[model samples]
Target chain A: MMRVLVVLAVVFATLPGVIVVLASLTAGQSLAFPPQGLSLRWYEVIFADPDFRDALLTSLTLATITSLLAVSLSALAAISIVRYRSRATALIEAMLLSPLAVPHIVIGIGILQLYGYFGLRADLLTLTLGHLIITIPFALRMLITSLAGMDRQIEHAAASLGATPRAILFQVILPQMKMGLLGAAISVFILSFDDVALTVFLVQPGYTTVPIMLFGMAENQVLPSIHAASVILLLASWLGVILIDRLIGFDRFLFRDGPSG
Target chain B: MQVAPAIRSSRLSRRATSLLLLAPTTLLYLTVYLGGLVMVLVMSIDVPPGVDSGGATLAHYRDVFGSAPIGAIVLRTLRDSLATVAGCLLLGVPVARYITASASRWKGIVLMAVLSPLMVSAIGRIFGWIALFGPGSVIADGLTALFGGKPTGLLYTEAAIIIGLTNLLLPFMVLSVASSRAHFEEDMSKAALSLGATPLSVLLQVELPLIFPGILSGALIVFSLSTTNFVTAALLGGSGRDLVGYEIYLDILVYFQQGRGAALAMLLLVVVVALMALAIQTGVQRHEVRDTAARTRGT
Candidate 1:
């Protein structure tokens, strides 16, 4: 039973990837599984198309900026919440994490409405802000875990040894937070990169991310080009996971100590 | 101990610094997230100016509940979400358990595969499904020929939506369950098996109770994701079955009913939060029971 389940699971997990790769390799104009012939024509088409190239670049840029902003903000917030013990701190923590509970679609609509009112409709900044709101929770959760696990005695000892406040933060605290920072940054990048629902509403003409462009293509018609894009995305994401594991232990990031700990 | 006073002053400074650091995040949450939620809630209550002269009526809520089309969409959304969550849990739990029980190398590979989807965009991943299940696809044609039936396209169907959402969300369940399964000690299971319990019995009686929290969390996450999902439903659900998320998009982007769109968005948010809270409450209750049991044993 276990073996059957494992095989089924592996097949289920790999089916989409396999289909995408096969479809991308189809020699025909339309997508076909068990491709009639094999070719890298779809990949070539994706590369040759200037729109796809631009969208890919935009996605990469947006992900980078959103991840950076989210990581810094969430790290600061997590550190503050942990350091200060107060009644309001719990409320604040809940508020920060509330984005996780709220559906991204509603947030997307809300952001559109809010930004529309402010005359900032359909801009990269709007998408960045929307992505930041969703990505903040992941970074905050990671940083909170890291801060909670950290032994404060070292910081106290540093202070006792005549280290300045900035010195204690930079030299003592920041070094220990390196793993957490990397994990948070990578996770934030992933979240921002994967964001489509939020980006859908905020995206304007000529500023499409890769996902939004893919969505548009799907809506128009499912072509082999979409499959090629999916294959690229899946490979990129898998590469990201491997890169993160190499940089910082993925297990450590996954199984962080809870807030109470 | 003259330095004691200086230490006290430094502590005060540290607090001030922490507060300063927290200000930006706090402000963003208030203005962007919480404020937007509040704005939507308020707008949900307000009657559309051209539709109704009555200010701040519950008419929008009434319309959402009374309209047959909207009500059916909501029901379909809930049903689809529940089915997706159930499917994910059924497939995810066993895989997670097996990975946890297996060698460390296999565990790492399984974990990576499970989490790989999280990195891919929902749009891209759904398009992957489209390629596989869309009209005239090989899978559909193969199944049709095997059954001696016509090749009916699976795209733009409820089944396709469920399948796509389940694939997208299964990793969430696997990761969550894997985390909880890591805490499960093998000794208890072995003891149960030695005491005349079958493997299935051991699983049901011992493992299930311990990992129930993980299951609940995973289900809640999947359900919430499915409920709020627009890309999958829009691409796969076709015109026959409209989800609330897609309807909201249509109202705002297609029909230009911004007020009604906001109203639907608010309703979706409320449902998601309510479900999440229920999940959290169950987890807390389970934790409390475990703690109480441990205390009783200590006594």
Candidate 2:
């Protein structure tokens, strides 16, 4: 009975993804599972469409910049959280994770208002800020988790050898946190890449992310090309998960609660 | 115990450097993130210019809560959130136990499989459901053939929303359960079995109590996550439903009702924060227990 339930759980978990892969292969104009005939025609169509092309570029670029910023900023904050023993450190840690407590839809519109008040256009910068607000928490949490379990002996050894702070940081601390850094980088990039709620209100029409664009298309009409778009995203996310498992080990990182907490 | 090498610099300079290290993150979080949050709260109560006399009123809250449909919407949101969490816990506990008990290399592969829905965007996975629940799809078609009735009512319903949210949340639930089991592994169960207790009794009496906190926090997390999501509820659930998430989206973008949207957003924020506080408090309590234990040992 126990084994049966685990099998069932795994099956249900991947069922939607499997259905998507099958649906995307359809030769039909509209979306449907169990395609009439398997074809790559829809994939070709989605790639040709400038909107999908631009949205893909915009999403990747936004994710890249957001993850880069999130990793560095959170690395600094994680040092404070792990290294220091100050009252303010706890406050900072709590505040950094505060965004996870609130709903993303609220943050999305709040960001819209923030930019609107300052007369800032809803472009890449605004989108990056929105993603940053969401992604920073994950980056901070991952680094904090990594730093917490780390042994301090190596840092002490380096300092006792008269190594400079910069050397110890670059060569000792960072190299130790490599897996954590990569995991943070991958998680933040994926979260920022696939964000829809934050992207929806913070995006300009032509400069929107892929999820936002796909959402609009999903809302307006059903198309097999959207399935193709989804299949590509699913594939991309699968690659990230695989990389996470290889680089750091998914069992180590992912068992912590998701960024939702 | 600072990680950086302590230089022989003056006290004030060390303080300044500490401030410098902390300043960037503090400034960004406060100015950009918290500032937006405050803006939303301000917009919620202070009615936009054209709507009313506009003197820091609770009129938006009064307007939102006074309406009958809003009440119904809140109830529906609650129902869906509860149902989704229930579904996730039902499925998640067994899987988490399986992962925790097994020492095989393939357990990592299984963990990845569990998180597949979560790592995939809600939009991507939900679109797949649009296919799965769509007419003439395999599941729908299979049902139609067997039952000899129209294959409908599943798509664009609360059922679909619940299923989508449950799948998205199952990984978290599994992780939480797995985390609790990590500290108390197979030893307890083995000890209980050695005492001649039945397998069923050992699981119920020995293990369930240990992992109950995990289940509680996981349920709360799922409740909070599923309730606040707009995209999954919107696309999978048709526009006819007045989900708080979808309604807030329409309120802000469609009707240009910023005040009401902000009010609704704040309400959702309050509920989500309260649940998260409980969840974190559970975690913090355990950490405090460990800290006190270490302190006692040191003394």
Candidate 3:
């Protein structure tokens, strides 16, 4: 019963993805299933279009920067929370994680309200900050879990052996956290990359991210390129999952290594 | 006396270092996150400029809650979210059991595959469902062929939204349940079986109660996420139906009625917060009960 159910679960989980891949090969204009013919025309069309090209670039750059900044910031915060053992740590963690429970649409509106209040125009920077608010919690949680489990005795030994503080940080601490750091960074990158509810509002008329652009296209017109673009994104994301799995050995039972569903 | 001074100095330095480590991220939380949320709450009551001719007013809230069409939209959104939660629970429990019971190296890979939906763009996944739910799709055609009737397209329906959201959340449900299941001792279940209890009875009476917290947590997560998710409904459920998130989005962006948008956003915030608080309180209570139970059992 368990094996059959597991197989069913796998089939159900991968069904939509498999359909998307198959549909991407349609030779026809519409996304008709059981493709009349097979071709890569959509992929070519997407490559030819500058909007998708620019949006992809914007998404990659934003995700890269956001992941780097949010992960490191959260790591520092996690260190303090785990190491300091203060009353304020509870309040700080709750505050940091509050954004997670808030609806993305609400967060988007809130950020928009913030922009209006400050008279600041929405741009990649503002959008980055918004994404940071959401992604930092995930990174911080992962780091905290790793930090809590770490062997501080090793660090103490290194210190007693006359190792410099910076050396202990680099050689002792960071190495132990390599998996958590990598997993958190991957999760952050993916979350930021695929973000939409907030990005839809923060994205300006001229500049856009892939998800925002995709949303716009899906709303208004049929871009044959959507198939190609979606396929590419789906593959890229799977690659990220694989990379994370290899790096962190995937906390399988909990599946906490990835972003929350 | 010599050691006392050194200990005091080291304590002071450690405190300073902790503060230093915490300062930057704390600053970010204060300015960006909390400040932004406060602004939204304020805007919810006080009208945004140029949206409508008004100062602080309850008119926006009235429009959201009092109006007939908007009420239906809210009801539909709630229905969709609840349905998604139920669907995920159905799939997640068995999958979670399978994962925790087996000593397979492939468990991690399977778990990742289940969560693979998160990696893809939300918009893209909705787009993917377009092919499956459309009239010309294989499943629709098969239905038509079997029924000797018109093809039943699944797109532009509430069901599509449910399906998409369930797909989006099934991983979370599985992860939650599986993690909780890991804490179950093999011997406990074995003992139950040895006591002449049927496997089914053992599962229902013994295992289900233990993992109920994980199930509830997963359900809360799905409920909160799906309620505010406009993507699936907007893309797959079509424009005929209006979800709260989509309505808020339109009110702000398309109509430029920021006041109304902010009001709806606040209402959504209230629902989300209430659910979150319930989850947190449940968590605290669960921990306390578990600790007490363990202590009594040990004694």
Give the top-scoring candidate (DockQ): 2
lDDT scores for all predictions? 0.79, 0.82, 0.80
Candidate 3 residue-wise lDDT, B152-266, digit = tens = 5777888888898898888878866766665566666798899999999999888888778878887888888888988777888877687888888888888877767888899
Interface RMSD of each: 3.1, 3.2, 3.2
Question: What does the lDDT read for residue B203 in candidate 1?
Answer: 91
Instruction: Name the candidate, 1 or 2, with the larger lDDT value.
Output: 2
Off by over 4 Å in 1: A257-261, B1-12, B51-54, B146-150, B289-299
Q: Is candidate 2 or candidate 3 better by lDDT?
A: 2
Report the C-alpha lDDT of model 1 over B1-299, residue by residue, as the tens digit.
Answer: 99999999987877788778888888887787776677677777877776747658777777777789888898899899999998897789888887677765666666666666666555656666777786578778877778866676677789999998898888888877776666566767898899989998899998898778878888887888888888889888877687888898888788887777888888788878998898777667666655654574469
Candidate 1 positional error at B114, Å = 2.4
**Candidate 3 wrong stretches, greater than 4 Å:** A1-4, A252-261, B1-9, B48-55, B104-109, B146-152, B284-299
Which candidate model has the greater DockQ, 2 or 3?
2
lDDT value for model 3: 0.80
- Go through the candidates in order and give the C-alpha RMSD of each one to the true structure: 2.9, 3.9, 3.0
- Which consecutive 10 residues in model 2 chain B have the weakest lDDT in total? B3-12
The pairs that clash in candidate 1 are: none
- DockQ of every predicted complex: 0.53, 0.57, 0.57
